[model samples]
Target: MRYSILTLATQALQKQQRWPQIIAPEKLKPHYDIIIVGAGGHGLATAYYLSHNHDINDVLVIDSSWIGGGNTARNTTIVRSDYLLPASFALKNFALQLWDSLSQALNFNLMYSPRGYLDLAHSDGELEHFMLRANAMCLGGASASILTNSQIAEKIPALNLDQQSRFPIRGALFQAEGGVVRHDAVAWGFARKSSEKGVHIQQNCAVNKLLTSNGRISGVSTHRGKISANSVLVAAAGGSERLMANAGVPLPMEPINVQAFVTEPIKPVLDHVVNYNAGLSYLSQSDKGELVMGGATDGYLSTARRGSFARLEDTMMRAAQIFPFISNLRLMRHWSGTADIPMDGNAIVGRTEIENLFVNCGWGYAGFKATPAVGWKLAELIADGKLPEMLKPFALSRFTDGALIDDAGIGPYPWLH
Candidate 1:
């Protein structure tokens, strides 16, 4: 199976169409060089880099449930690095470069097709933001372009080019490197490869509390037993605060459930991934030609993935507005995933007040796009015990220091999930 997230995340287990890999129980040791909590893409990728790049093989990964059972596998696969701001641009560009080499680096088929992604500019502000991002990405060696209405009309002929049709179909910013990949393949590719390299991926192992002594993190108390380690990386997505709270490291994050759904497989259409900035929604035609649409943050304090039918209704109505042709497509399946929504739109990735406990959460909806850079940088921090200059700015203390990355870069709001 190919790992399909825009970034190649070596997975821990794969649930495929047939012959799925089993997630079995495993006992945790009392000690390890490092222990990474939450066996999602970020944790697994960190473990992979720690073993491969830093040669630290005594690393263990613990997940609350089966791997990829979090937001890691639930995102609508869209990849781009054309960010308006500098920091988001830097991280995304770095991730794009790593994505370019992911297939070869993982020695597997990522099915990474850079078939170009388009961001529709409905209003003047949206247009301005796209133009600024186009320039930023261009300077960063990305093949990004600002396309006029005529050009958009030429590419997507089915779209309503008439004025006053909600969006009016204004100019669009096109990033040729922006594309979609198979999300599931990425998780499995990373997990299988990393597990083979001797990294222990323990699924269904929920870390209940952290064990610390004299202001230093030493181990973790889980559902099964306790495990000791020198360094502990809490890569948990929605469960970030629950685990880190025990260590006195609080993240300004609340796990909000984001829902998405797909239509039944139809004939191949909507070749390119389309995102309407004005409507704040995105949809991509999957390999099976199913229109996979996802938008809007949902559920403020709910942990259960109970997606509201109203969300499905609202999103479907919005989809019909964006692509009038999709109104006829029948709904197939709907699901929701938890998002570690930070107060600021940016992610936290660095050491916290707790001595050896690290964090890599608050991805919102765009973390899948930055997995490669995150894994590489997080590995460096874990192995060397120091945060790099770029990642240092996104520390957990940003909320208190007021140095938060309040970048509305790709998100809908400046301070929302």
Candidate 2:
């Protein structure tokens, strides 16, 4: 049933009992044209585009747990394209553009809010650095500008703008079009649309290993059984390392735990997505008035979906210092997800050593924002057997050839990313 005002009226009159399930269960076939190993946003979006745009309907998406039950649903859904590098900005800005029309395109409400995004600068050096970043972002097709202390104060009145405070706010880089979206809604929308187009989605069915032959791709051996595929795309964020290893290819990435939390519901306090550069913390107010917040990674390697208390405490402390009102709020919930951070603090999206074994992992904590573009480009890559120009710089080959797209310029430290 297509969702609309008329459908809503009919459903209400019918007592809403005729609503169909989002995705129906289907038995897996022994063979498929393409198989995606993760049912997260990126994987599902790729399947959707493969069937919708490329007319390749014989696709299957298998996940260990449930659809979007991984980082897709675990993130604090901040989306932005104000990156300092050209490649990163191009891919991300494409996704940001797609985000604007995603709800209508998928016939689902993704709840995308383009309030704005701010990166606070506490020192003069940081302000100068932000100026350089803003110029790069503007040149790369993202709307960015540097705002002075008074301008930032006008934007965020709750911020601790006093110069006497620790890490005083000096200025900021503002991207007026960047904001947040409903993370799980993206997963569900893509899943429902893909299932409608005859793509298969299997949950609780893990791919134990990648089955390869003669340096080419064959398929995957899953918990249920061995399934055959002409091509396989492993977009399984944190778990990609193990799956790639199964294909005899080593990924230069580390999966580390990242945590986020929300405060109890209150009146609307924050409008724009705010980031404290000195503290390395970020936050935004949800539609429900809950202050959604997150900070740095655990600074170590781990696949566990749990974070250390010390890191959480440090983040909250930084958040409280920036916005004193946070001190009065009680915690609503806290959770963590593992991100396969690359050595250069950037994503690795391209073909592996195996001919037909493609990958779209190592996005770290930025996967949610890049979902639409990654899915679209990955679908094209699989369909045309070529890498998109925007994705070339992020290829696995860059790590070896010293062409690392280190957006953070933090060296080859995945932990710090």
Alpha carbon lDDT at 24, candidate 1: 24
Candidate 2, residues 1-417, lDDT tens digits: the string is 688999999999999999898887767999999999999999999998898889998999999999979999988899998787888889999999999999999999999999999999999999998999899987777789999988988888888888998799889999998999999999999999999989999999999999988888889998788999999999998889898986888899988899999999999779999998875789999999999999999999887788899889988999998899899999989999888899998998978878888998998998899999999999999999988898899899988899999888895989977
Q: After superposition on all CA atoms, how large is the RMSD of candidate 1? A: 4.9
Candidate 1 Cα errors over 4 Å, as ranges: 1-27, 409-417
lDDT value, residue 149 of candidate 1: 86
Off by over 4 Å in 2: none
The per-model lDDT (C-alpha) reads 0.79, 0.90
Top model number, TM-score: 2
The alpha-carbon RMSD values of the candidates against the true structure, listed in the order shown, are 4.9, 1.1
What are the clash counts of all predictions, listed in order? 12, 0
lDDT for 227 (candidate 2): 97
